[model samples]
Target: MADGNGSEKEAVVVSNKQVVIKNYVSGFPKESDMEIITGSIKLKVESGSKAILVKNLYLSCDPYMRLLMRPQGWEEYSLLKSSQGLFKIEHTDVPLSYYTGILGMPGMTAYAGFYEVCSPKKGEYVFVSAASGAVGQLVGQFAKLFGCYVVGSAGSKEKVDLLKNKFGFDEAFNYKEEPDMNEALKRYFPQGIDIYFENVGGKMLDAVILNMRIHGRIAVCGMISQYNLDQPEGVHNLMSIVYKRVRMEGFAVFDYYPQYGKFLDLVLPNIREGKITYVEDIAEGLENGPAALIGLFSGRNVGKQVVVVARD
Candidate 1:
């Protein structure tokens, strides 16, 4: 150790590992779509560039990242959609990975899409597809917090358990086990759904439209089911949207960055008080990033998937 601000430091170069897209993909993404490679970077930043170097402790594995892997113009669309409000970790006490999940883009998507877009009220029926996912889990919990009857659909029993037992959802079912989506929605929302936080698309959207109450709101954050499909399925029940006079709106999380401070103030205390809970599926090491990312399309991850690059 040396006196503060006295010693001259030497720069060190290290092997920086990265997971890069091996090639543009056409259909469902596989681990082969990406490959881990190493490059060298200086441990110290340049003297006057005003650039901040992040250690990259956690890399988020979000479903939207998959859209970028697709061939054609989607790569450009992905960049435009995902380029704003990037986070740089500052606090070290809380898990750094939270920035990639509950405190990050997914958190804002759940907050803005539900409260800002859906305009939820007390005792309303709220249904969230892909409920065990990062954004969906948060949306279900927020609906419960807002005094709504909350139900979620997942792909596996474990995810269903997480929705009901951990996230405080009123009910949850495995969508894969339920062949008739309209019946599944009917079973969960006997009174008809007033708010649907739309994550998965395709037949789920069609079913939800038919089951929506008058003036029901749908906040479209993503359409994960369509991201990998060569030909996206058509929602035949869109006519129901007009018939029921429902409000259907699509939103991106980028539009809500100004509310981030307000969101943190509301959520951080709930987390500390155990009123809110979050789950993450962390894949240790950067090399596992490909598998962790590919897992999203196949429903192999139970919660928010994150890849740990470095530990401090």
Candidate 2:
């Protein structure tokens, strides 16, 4: 390490271009749809405004950002409609990347989507999709910590290995090579699923639906495998939800922003003491950002897909 001369760098805020969604996407967003065009940024925060001016050191590449790609979201809710200040920045002691995973949208999603939505009980049976990915990995670990029997499904064998060995998941399998998804799910979730953390929708969801236990709960975090498709796949096991008395729900992390502090308070200590661990698949430079963002659909990213913008 080298010592500095104790000089502060001048803040500049002439123009900033961000990756913004051009329009509502039907399915599978292309790189061309998002462009880095010129936008304004204030160098200093205004007084009386709790807003913060962040340099965006690192950006999280999350699946839900795809939903935000659509113009109409919770930000446009009739009762919650906002004419101004939709996207704002704030400061935190943790790395900016945390906002993408742990402290960010995905973390809160895993927290609220699991505990609040799934309403997991101790030692219950749990299954997660995209288990080694950002949200699934954390969800599996969370289930284990809650004394639940957890199994996860990933797209690759390496991710499966990491889920079972590295993340301490009870069991994990690669969905890609699995001949029959339903049979695979039945083999792993032999006792039926008490809680299903839905990640990749379509056929995988159909299988989980067929194997759900009575009074099961399903938390719809995302459908990565279905994001890129022009037409979303329909689940054939819809009757199971009614027969099994399953409760399925969809949620967004933005609605739970108020609970973020409460969330960090719960997860931070675990992180510091090594009780919880997070994995990231970081891509350097902004040029490769497009590919990294698209990789989520393909299940190419081993963990959380993060893009490094700048480091200060």
Candidate 3:
């Protein structure tokens, strides 16, 4: 084993492979848009930077990763930017790739967005769109732990089943089969939605808006449905935002990272106790990263998508 200085009596040079974004992307990024280059791995950490050097093991494939691959577009400070909350992964069990989904940004996204933004209360009726995805899955579980009646929507029948059986959602439905989102919302939330975790956006948001109880809250995490399209579908029921006196706000997880420790305190115990469950679809090797990423928009991943780069 190396000493604290990260070196032995003799200097050692280790080969390193890094996954680099080919460049900013346009439309859906292809496999060619990313390339893994080899280099030397430094065993030492630099001073004055909170950025820790990680030997990446499990990298996540999230829908928001699309924006980063996009040729610099209009998307704001999300996973897209030159140095935004992009994943230059390095995960392991101790600091594993699974952490990237449950304990990383997605975890924080669920914590801050649910606790701070949604501010859910016991017995509240909470509904989450794309509830089987990374952030949404955690949000639903958190809501359940908060003693709320939680429901979720997913694209496939299997995912819907997973949400209900595995994630402990009170109810779940396949949005693909539901011809009308409003109907699905009503069916699951007859009492009306007190908290709506917006993920898919577009029609789903509109549908949730119509069913939101008075003084309801909405945490807008993303709009995956509109990401690839040149022109996104507009919400015709925006007026409902005013009439319902609903509070709707969008958020990015990075701004809330400072409180990550506190959030983890609240979640880790539950995770260890089996009170909370997280899902991940792991892709091995950098070569599979592209397909894993592209498949996100199509709901090809059952839960959080992770890519493994190297192992210790």
Candidate 4:
């Protein structure tokens, strides 16, 4: 640890760039609400400390992050107290960015929500909202692989096409073009949906509830439509759950992290054998983080939105 002069070398310092909130957000978020600043930090973690310092390669932009922009929400940085909650990347043959989408939290959310929460049966009629997104796309693919008739609803014609053509959903529709969601559901699923992967809530949930078959299962994964609103729109068909004997349940991915290994075992093989496919919208550099993160609420980015800070 000494130079030619026998003096100890100083710890290497680097300029660390970060995206920080300029102020707590209200309503829809904008790029101006966040600021990118550079700060210096030593490369080494302190001795006797349990902290781990990591260089971020990819950062995920998800719908849930909109809530973290509020004053009461929680946020975490690259430095960690320990590796307790971290999952090491075991398979690197696939794109490392997969860790941000298909091999990461979104993948887990789709797996746990569909297989565990929905308890799907083969040949069942399944529907997914926000169908082309990170989680919804996987849910659709999983249903197809499991012998279910999967239908997905996306916001745009392009996304709807991606859902049907790229991801192999049985059917996909642009929800924006559908005037009556109830009728739309009836068209895609004449027999009524046996399983619904609830991503877009409010009106869509109301329609899905009305169209659900007896003893249907609804896995409430997320409600992207309600995130930016001051007052979330209410679903009027709560009583339908009673009459139809539907099992409606909400889940968080954090609760299923314990089964991460099990999830990888199931998905990795499918990924390798071409039984599954994934899509991502990648925004490069830390400077563009704000815009990339803000893009989620507006459905501006297709597929899984990822921010690449560095490659190495």
Error of 2 at 227 (Å): 2.2
Q: How does model 2 score by TM-score?
A: 0.82
Give the residue spans of candidate 4 off by over 4 A: 1-9, 70-77
lDDT of 4 by residue, 1-312 (tens): 122222324566677777888888988999888887776656666667789888888888999888888532112235578878776787999989999899899999999999999999999999999989999999999999999999999989899989988999989999999999999999999999999999989999999999999999999999999988899999999999999999999999989988999999999999999989999999988887888888888888899999888887
Where is model 4 poorest over a 10-residue stretch in terms of lDDT?
1-10
Tens-place lDDT digits, model 2, residues 1-312? 122223413434445545655676667677776655555544644445555555556777888667667642211001222225344435455566766787677888899988889999998999999899889889998999999999998988899999998889999988888989889988998889999999889998999999999999999988877777778888788999999999999987778878877887889888877888889999875656767887877778988888887764
Best by TM-score: 4
Over 4 Å off, model 2: 1-27, 35-53, 70-94
Model 3: CA > 4 A from native: 1-15, 36-54, 70-95
* All candidates: CA RMSD (Å): 5.5, 7.2, 6.2, 3.4
lDDT scores in order: 0.84, 0.79, 0.80, 0.88
Query: Can you rank all candidates by TM-score, best first?
Result: 4, 1, 3, 2
lDDT of 2: 0.79
Per residue, candidate 3 scores C-alpha lDDT tens digits across 62-118 of 888777773421110112113344454332233466577888889999898999999
* Candidate 1 per-residue C-alpha lDDT over 133-200 given as tens digits, one digit per residue, 9 for 90 to 100: 99999999899999999999999999999898999999999999988989888887888999999999
